[model samples]
Target: MNRHVTTGFLPGSALAGADLALPGVVPLERRRLQCYLALLFSDMAALFSGFAAAGWLYLGPDGLAQGSHLAQLLLPIFLTVALYNGTYSLHSLEHALSGAIRAQIALGLAASAVLFIAFYTKSSASFSRVLFSGGIILSSLMLAILRAQMRSFVRWRCGGRIIHEIVICDGGVPIVLPGARVIDAAAHAITPALDDPVSLHRIGVLLRGVDRVTISCHPSRQRAWATILKGANIDGEVVDDAVARLGAQGARIVSGHGLLRVSVGPLGLRARALKRAFDLIFASCALIALAPLLLAVALAIRIEDRGPVLFVQRRVGRGNRFFDMIKFRSMTQSLSDPHGHRSTLQGDPRVTRVGNWIRRTSIDELPQLVNVLKGEMSIVGPRPHALGSQAGNKLFWEVDERYLIRHALKPGLTGLAQVRGLRGTTLHEDDLVQRLGADLEYLDGWSIWRDLAIIAATARVLVHPRAY
Candidate 1:
């Protein structure tokens, strides 16, 4: 499942230092997804096997009914617990024992929850005591063995294959490492020409083939370096501490490379799945429930303004990717600034008669449920900004160095900042800062229930003064 490569760099090559770093990619999603799905299937198989074994060992055919009851009630909960604990993350799978423990805990917790509910509801007699107890014990032992074997497979295949890379500045000091391997049997690097923006295609081709690319930049060439980083559609690690300047922490040390990537927040595998599921369920239901309301809003906008009903604009999202966010047109199309360099005032002349009401009631934002379904935005997250969004005289990113941190998660239809009264137009530096603070707060402490709470709280402030 991994690439086999012949080492390219020579032993005498000057590849060392903290200043030499690799540009990153989103990582091997196809591989990761395969691994994740395999683990999930493995768990299911083990659960079933254990249950089947226990049923036969306990009370014959009647015990089979007991196993079914427990499995039907507990599987979803167990999966959810595993998701919350990052048990299925590609990053976490390196240590298989931890994953197994989390899995075991998930099963135990689900079993316990069911046990409590069954007892409290006066339904304990419905479950076979022998089957329940035996199933749990057998499942735990089998899962632990499976996990250990999986880890052994990974260790046997990859443990010797990862390389300890050293990226050093040309003519700078070189350090020595004890267990560092100069060559990797499992992975390869592709360093393309970085002379100009014209070389972007060559870089992109190389990036598609490799996990990492070492980028070396002098302190004086920050602008050129940033330009290169911006133009390339890859995760970048700066040799300089610029990422540290931008509020990213070292996630982990990989293969003895001390360099840490600059990231706004931890990218989660489970969070992506959970959020997508939540958004699909929530958006689909809300769309169905509010069909008439959506239709009415569209008809009103079209009739009142004699213009297109929907307003669409490009907004920056996670990892600086841009997507068109849709809304009911709430302003005079001819006069409205789509790039939004200037903040909207409460009584702006650009606001149309229908626009005012829709904007105030947040009916204009209802169309973004499609964006949520499209996977461009979440039901709850930091609201995205237009390309030229400004706070006072400065660009939004210029207002706060941490402004880009908001892009770490998907932009939302409604966010913590909005419900907390930091919505409307950003008229001052403090406005964006406060909203940023709220967004950061949400990011730092995110959960499925937290998102639900935000969604619920959002209904209470749907018609706030700051909304316009």
Candidate 2:
């Protein structure tokens, strides 16, 4: 039986992509940001007020001291931690209950820290336990109240609509979500093209200015546009009816047709910030530590052929943006082909003597740490590919949709595929598929530990025969 489906995505994912929106409203992102900031201040005030009230009730009129301390130390800690945890990100706090829970978690963590600090300072006697307990309860309650009242005002300000959702569906049926707007685009026509400049340009234009969700019923279309959507941190959804058909690829399924909206980018808010922070710190340290080695390599390349020591080329990256990737010049400067044809064979004649040693030892790649520092690349992710890079005559993206999915993340200095010996030529279809699979796996299951593991594996791969 030939079955037709809206998208090959999970049924859960289809409805999960639905969002509420109003016509003529400010771009959705800006609205959300404003709401987040408003609520952040409200939360801070609510916490402070709660503490002050508790102090007055339990510790006489002088309870403002503890409230002052909490405002100074604990409040900042809670807000900072919450920012990374994504509790308040992506408008997840629109729901009063969700907002309340997130507030409680942040406050609870901060309150616990205060308890420990009091014990450590041997000042538990100075801190009023009754007021402290009361403050926690009161703060949580007030924030929940503030969120509920604010949601109404926010919705009113966002166009006075109770249900503001945008949907893309294949059926002749009504928009599944109540009071949602649907944009009709046939599933087949929405197939995403990788290198087709016209299509890429059109998609970007069409999806721009849409602060709310830009949805589609084609999974490949969603995947191809994934980079743009992720890069902008805007919303894009895959709508499908077949529960059995949707392979999450790397996306997590959080609900059954009612899942929370998830970022197409694999890493969550906090992890991403930490990863970028780590990249900056690590890249800075490496550049400082390897200054001598980098200089020596540059000198060697110059002394050998009197050519440019660095080889920079256009490479596709996160959100499909192109950047100049820098590497040590490893091929003979005269024979260097930006549009490469010769494979890195066991003994390629095009490789200069100095180039061969640098390429083999992975010293040629040291310059990319600068890209990491510049925010063009990451320390770990799918390695970026040259625009027309191919296996035989077929490009990597030409092979399958999965290859394009790798761009959902920023390209990396080292990747899971390279560490797994999938570097060099893409001999056949499986080569691209497996390599894409590894990249997807890394994105889906990423953690600090996994990143560390990839880094360790990268070190081993540098000396491996496959690296050449």
Candidate 3:
């Protein structure tokens, strides 16, 4: 069961790797753009040809000239209305009848607008009303036929629908979707976890570039899956008939199953762009400003134990993926806990004099600015933790299921938990609970102003007592 059951995935597919293999499905967004352009071009051609043919048959060259003018005027207006009425949307791409009807409505509106303008401008005599009406009817028929043919084109081009959908079966009733990639979660050991990097990474790989994700999981695991999906930044749905009984807010009935819409991306495209730009600009400036200090620390670390000046440890980052986090080495090379299996206690023998001072002042973490520049971390978000990080006698995720939700955003150098003085090791379950609460809170209604406030607040805690 090392490899989960995957349908539609072909050998040598572009998205395949040693860990997971996916079908060479074109991205849904790109597919939709292609469909929209096809429809637009076809519609333009149909409109012009239908009107020109009618005009040439009715009043010769004079009518042909008038029809060309009419089509030019109608095209822009029709396109505008069609865009608003879902004529060129995903629903339209999926349902030919619905899209065709919407297209007719848009065309009707554009014709009415053209007639209204002609009447008001005393230009009604410029073209024969009967010929114009005839042209509209002919165009309507052509457009309808064109839309019907589009169904065949879409079936050929997109395999029917212009979206990528996946279904995950996790200890629940197995179901089928006509064209969706289905995965058996248990076969892959893909559980929703905050600290289990393997599980998170596997899940992330499974979901990359998916537009819609539907989960069928046991009732006990629904909440955990919901949290994971929220951080995944996709359209997430959970199948459960009892959602109505529980009063799920975003629930809907799809194909006879009750689907609870658990999450859309936490940040929209514009917001993510703004945040990334902020991180890059600031991280680059900080690195340049502190270059001399960074060199001094690195040189000192090398002089101490003659070990590598930087400690590179694998930590869970955004989307629950692992990344090598950089930090100035603070402990003896032999004693460093790469997996963070052990907490550093006060007066620990492994801490050298320089290591102790840098750890106290939080200077050892300065190298993580490089991680920020590399886009592996953020300046303000929930901090990433080592895979084996734990609280009390259990892993951090084992102590609290909601611990994973914080990972929806990039791991930050200083986060809400750090600003709130929750930087120490999770010695007990309650310690994790307190920090988890802060991390979850920070995920809500994120804004640039809030990030700046957190960054300002973080300065106060740089020399906090818990830095050990």
Candidate 4:
């Protein structure tokens, strides 16, 4: 199956006499190692040159080498910090700003450390204050400007491929990776046979210059591929659709069996603490600020039909458990659909006059602040759905098996999907599809900053046209 779907500057080789001819991919590890060394040397030169230049300008020709001592003292510290901060790492090669910011941080930390040492050691008087200040300013500016141009430098040095990565398809889902070479295992006789020396040799040759290899294959073949990858001594990944379907965070072999970690909580302890604190604080503040409006809406709903002011309906929440979600009563008491089997439609006869206005402005959902305060819901997450909710004729879970994965986190009053106007009714399967996609994306990456942004975006859609 060895076809070069993505040429990536490597010319595909023609088969010769039953032998697999893999395209020549220059080993990338050496190139990346060389790039790292180049950055280190360039940084050293920048620091030394900046100091020497500053010394000349500030202290005349007599002090051309005056700041050389400081440069020498700071070089190791800066390089060590830069390595840890990823200034000379692969991510730095991709984005110039990432590397520049890291470089600046490294330089700042190094300078601070040197000055702190000098101060405590009573050696501050030895170095001229003006020379030290001028050196730091010049070196920092040079580093930032130099790093800004390193993207092109790395591109030139590494040629077209920054990482020699390849994706080998072995009878599984086909995937496209931007800069990776694609190979077909069947076309190349690349079988996962441990006993077949010829096939093992073929695999080795194909992976010779590669840094990382990803195989997309059926579950039956995954074990074989995993065995081969482990012996190959390269970074490897086996694509399993089950991992995504099960929301598995990672996998590990324990007690002579593999375990897929699907039960892990979305947020870590620290993240949970931060999110809970944020939910409580925001919900509390919002409740107080909107009290007058909440009271007015309640009064309106109560007076409209002389019915109960609040509607409590059973809906799915975090951990796939049932919770009574509260909202302003929006339908005639006798006509209210508690199980949500029937989605409300525009001009639905059951909706009262007050229900129309409150639902339109999302005033009806304000009562969920109590849910947030009770820790049953988050300020932002996938919105809770009633058990009987349907997308078209199919129940939501029946329409898509991944629907329940949304319950891994607490349901929210506002969510990534809702803010994007994917709220209101799930009229079609496609509607749920769009919302589920957004919900899964939110689950993949949760951050307080993103939550804040979603909340801010929610304000714009409070009175969306889709509201019934």
**For this target, which candidate reaches the highest lDDT against the unseen true structure?**
3
For candidate 1, the 10 contiguous residues with the lowest summed lDDT are 1-10
Total residue pair clashes for candidate 4: 5
Q: lDDT of each model, Cα atoms only? A: 0.65, 0.66, 0.81, 0.76
Which ranges in model 4 have alpha carbons more than 4 Å from their true place? 1-249
Each model's TM-score?
0.65, 0.69, 0.68, 0.51
Q: What C-alpha lDDT does candidate 2 achieve relative to the native structure?
A: 0.66
lDDT of 4 by residue, 4-87 (tens): 112221112211112454567877666776777777777888899888878889989866768787788889999889878888
Residue pairs whose backbone atoms clash in candidate 3: none
Q: How accurate is candidate 1 locally (lDDT)?
A: 0.65
lDDT minimum window of 10 residues, candidate 3 = 1-10
Error of 1 at 322 (Å): 0.6
What are the per-model numbers of colliding residue pairs? Answer: 6, 9, 0, 5
Ranking by lDDT: 3, 4, 2, 1
Q: Candidate 1's residue-wise lDDT over 1-468, tens digit each?
A: 001101211112212211222343223544556667778878877787777779878878877776766766777887888888777864556566678878998888878988898889999897787788888888888888777767655544344322222232322123233442222211333222232111222233333323333344455543333433333323444445455543434434444544435432333556667888999999999999999999998898888888898887766665444567889998887877665556778898988988899888989899999999988888999898765676666666666655655666789998889888888777688888998899878878688988999999999999998877
Error of 4 at 156 (Å): 59
Any runs in candidate 2 off by more than 4 Å, and if so which?
1-45, 56-89, 92-130, 133-191, 194-198, 201-235, 238-263
Arranged by TM-score with the best first, the candidates are: 2, 3, 1, 4
Candidate 3 lDDT, tens digit per residue, 290-354? 99999998889889899999998777777666678998889999999776777888888998888
